[model samples]
Target: MATVARTSMLGRLGDMTLPIGILAIMAMMVLPLPVVLLDTFFVSNIVLSLLVLMVALHSYRPLDFSSFPSILLIATVLRLALNVASTRIVLSEGHSGSAAAGKVIQAFGEFVIAGNFLVGLLVFAILVIINLVVITKGAGRVSEVSARFTLDAMPGKQMAIDADLNAGLLTPEDAKVRRADVAAEADFYGAMDGASKFVKGDAIAGILILVINVLGGILIGTIQHGLSAGDAAQTYILLSIGDGLVAQIPSLLLSIATAVIVTRVSSSHDMADLIGKQMSLRRAWVPVAGVMALLGMVPGMPNVLFLLAAAGAGAMAYFSREDGDEAVEGEVMPGAAPQAGGAAAAPAGGDESSEGIVPEDVTDNAPISLQIGYGLIQMAGGENGALVSRITGIRKDLSKAMGFVVPGVRIRDDLSLPPNSYRIRIGHRIVGEDQVYPDRKLALPGGASVRKLRGIEVRDPSFGMDAIWILPQQVTEAESDDYVVVEPESVIATHLSQVVTSNAADLIGPDDVQALLDNLSKVTPTLVTSVVPKLVPLHTLTAVLRHLLAGRIPISDLRRILEGLAELSGRNLPPIEMAEALRPSLTPLLLQQLGSITQPLPLITLDPELEQILIRARQAGDLDGGLVVDNGLASTVITSISEAADKAAGEGRTPVIVVASPLRRSFAAFLRPHMPDAIVIGINELPDTRRVEVVAVIGGQAGIPAPNGAR
Candidate 1:
């Protein structure tokens, strides 16, 4: 009974916290506060303001501190209530001296202002000017503009979320989270715009309160207390200015905090680190050192101070250069490929390789790794590593699409690679290797431009489009010529994304599939328990999922996939056959990703005669695998399909090939090596709800035929 009572008592007290705080603030304004309590409250106010400022500086994004507006309002109201209470004390006790109001006010008057009322007043005025006219005003304006823009962009942001969801780049749960963040962001800025007025009003109220206290104190001291005019002026004026200073300093800090929050851009780093990294450029510091050294030599300058400043800047430059070098070189990890002839000589005994071996010596365990040459190292290291952030985003998006978390990419520098090259590996196999120029931009020429740009021509690594390696300064000129300019880091990141996405099947394993089942059990426990390892073994289920992924099918709807598997459990089919059987139910997912339901799906179809010939060839020769056709016929069919796919691509449409259901899987597999980009679907997989537009008919010389209407 005692323990229960104690728990109940704590919960009740927690519930009363807000109401109690409100009552205390109101009492501060209505009743007289003892000197000790007033001093404590004054100190508490300063501490609260500093705490707020620190939180604002450390917040990675505005939404990270979404309650700041409410907090700001409470702090402003508390400050105003303190002002009212202090004003009462100042007016009633001024004749007694500066210590009459509180020790905090007295300390500000004597210690801060050196017992000079004039200095205290001047300092308070400057603080008020800074808080009211500069920081508070600027923060309010920024809040207003940010709120307006955020609200204006809400529709577009929501549409983008929906588009990504439909495209399978975001799961429904991820879309919901993104939508909530967007709405919260809009509400935060809107609240911030209104809360800024409280800060402005607080600054104004401080100045007015100070003026009133000073005027009232002097009148009461001289007339009612019968003090001399100069004595009243000296004593009362000091007390009033000190009271204002104590309140105004905290108000200034809050104003600066408000400005920091309103003007802050969302970043992964804190304000201090972000600013430090951006300001640590060696080239920028070198110029500053040179200018400072030149000024130190001028005849009228303070040579000692100027030379010291020069030396400081020079030190910063040297350290910045050293930091850059360390960041680049230290990025190489333990798994990096060794340099030729640079391996340590064997010990007095035989080579260690002859005696024993470790796991790392035999194989890399990481699912995905990026190996960059020394010259391209800077793009993947240090505080502002663009490639790192981009790869993180890719993993997140791919995880949503693949229905499981994508493993993190490990980055390392390889000494054996050419200085300007990079290699992307999945497990132990290298998937992509390409060269890039860190100092240059890749400009892809669009067909709309007639003039050729002057630069070294190359093929785009991601898409194999004709591109030029142009100077960074020529970006604007290239854009004017209808060329798309891409950064080197973006080029590398895009290639990595493409490679990972294409080989997504290779990345998933039995363990990953088990993780998917574990997550599914939380929501649909019976389905997971009944289907996985009972109807289908874990490895077989993993193989089925890999086959779907190889066909560019998203497994995000794991519950639906499991339910489908349960219905087919009695057959005891192989993984490939099970996966093929599940495709009809999962076709909507693939179609929605290709295009929206509102637009007709662009399809490339083979001629009826050719389709029958391929199906017959597969049945006669290799019924279990791809169609086995004569070389001459295969060459002719591939050429015709390639031309049609290219034409549709030039017209900005994703071409989907429609084939008979019996030949769909084999034909798709056969075309995988030659036409990797082609998406082959069974005619039955085309839903009746979505319309289809026939873009081309391969292996025929006739005019275009009418598209099959809606399925």
Candidate 2:
């Protein structure tokens, strides 16, 4: 009871700290203070500014210090309040001596400026110019641009998240977290943009306060106290300059902190570590050493200093070379893409010929593997690379969407491939291969671009959009032309993401399904026991789940899936038939992926005559053991769908086709070749809760609107 009461008291005291400090600062502006008390406050002001600068420098990212804007505002107010209090003492007590205001001002006047007001004024002017004109101005501009770009990218980012959620790459919970982070990032930058103005205003105010204190003190000293003109000028000017210097120094430190925060890139390491790693390259240091040695040999140079610098650079180059070689040998695979979290290949171990067909030598059991050529190894191997993080995020997203943990991907180098080429494999089957330049970026042109770019043109590997491989220096130029620029790492990661998501069904097996059941048993043991071998066998359950996954249905709600299966247990249905029966229960999940509940689902439909023809063809195919539709008729129907789906996509809607329940399976199978991404659903599969708009209809002869004319 005593500990609890003491904890409560401490919490209450912590809550009162900010309000009390603010009130004290306000009081300082209005009330006069003794010299001793004034000196302590001056020291405190300097300490606070130094503390803020340290925090800013140590932050890994700007959002890590989200409260910096509020801190900056409070510090600005504190400094200005101190200016007012010190100005009062300077003018009221200048008739006595420079030390009349306080020791802080007295030290700056006597020691720092050597009692010369002219030198003090010059130093103060330089500090203000550096703070106000250079650092503060540049920081304000960077903040404004960052805020604008972040806000501009929000809609696209949100749409990407929704697409991932729909594709089953992200869970609703993960999506929520990503959204909150995006909003916080935008808010942080926006606040920083506004806070920069306070520093600028404070600098201007500092100049005005100095002028007012000097003129006011001299007038009072000579006129009111009957002092000589030169004596009054010397006494008052020294005190006033000293007071301005004390305030300006702290202001300069705050300005530098603001600049550092706005310009910082979001990285896992702080500024020092990131810079250190990036600079520790043997290739970069070797040239510096050579250049320094060359300079040392030139006549009329400082040969000793130059020679010493050369020797230090040469030593750094040697050590850097050793580290790089060790990193490559240990981390990179010689003949395949190295797996991120998998076991490394064993050393030769007394010649492979003598071992003669070792079991581990010829087989890879990993579910997924990535093979990159030697030139691209740096992107997937080094501490400076972002590919590892990107791949990890992809796996996380896939795990949430697919309702199972995606296996770790193994990455290795392939000596037979071209230097810039990479291939992705699922088990032993190659899924995707592409080439990307490590030092260049892929720029996709948008509608706003008024001119063409000059580069090597190709289609985007993930989306098939027209793109160009351009030099890194051309990013700003491309962005100005309204091109969406992407780095090479993103290009590879996106392709990998699409390939893995499309094949999510192949990545799961009986073991994964059984694990899911085991985890569910902890929460609902009765449901698991009743449904597992007693009704649906584990192998049958795995097959059913693979079918649902192939159709892009998430099984995260395993309870609901099991419940639906239990209802049809006595029917003795096959896996395909069982998956079909569960569609209605899962339609709401697909609907959410299409859009929010309030947004109408955009849909396409076949005209009545076309529906009849397809239905008749399917029936005949079942009877004759083959589909007997005329080749001309099938071609016409496919062409019509391709056009409608493409048009709907251009208008920013997901292309969905609704058909009669009897024809859905056969019709979807027939159209899969041409329109692989379009969703074909039985009319009954759509829930009654969703409102849909018919955007296009194929087959126009029976008084139905044409594909181009449908609304």
Per-residue lDDT, model 1, residue 459, is: 93
For candidate 1, write residues 1-711 as lDDT tens digits: 999999999999999997899899999999999989999999999999999999999998888999999999889889889989988988888788878988899888787578666787888899899999999999999999999999999999998788566544455688899999999999999999999999999989988998898788778888999988888888877877878888888889988888999888887799999899778878899999999999999999998899999999999998774233322222222112212111122357754554575675446677888888878776776555677767766766677666676776877676678988999999999989999998899998876877788888899887777899999889999999988899898999899888888899999998888877876787889888888788878888899899898887888898888888888878878888888888888878878877678988888888898888888888887758668788888887787777777777776777788899988898899898787667888988888888888877765344244455544
Candidate 2 residue-wise lDDT, 134-238, digit = tens: 998999999899999988988987887786666455557778998898899999999999999999999999999989987888889989999888888888888
TM-score of each: 0.70, 0.62
TM-score of 1: 0.70
Top TM-score model = 1
Model 2: residues with Cα > 4 Å off, grouped in runs: 321-367, 374-416, 427-506, 509-561, 564-711
After aligning candidate 1 to the native by TM-score, how far in Å is the CA of 536 from where it should be? 1.5
Q: For each predicted model, how many residue pairs clash, with residues at least 3 apart or on different chains? A: 0, 10
Alpha-carbon lDDT, every model: 0.82, 0.81
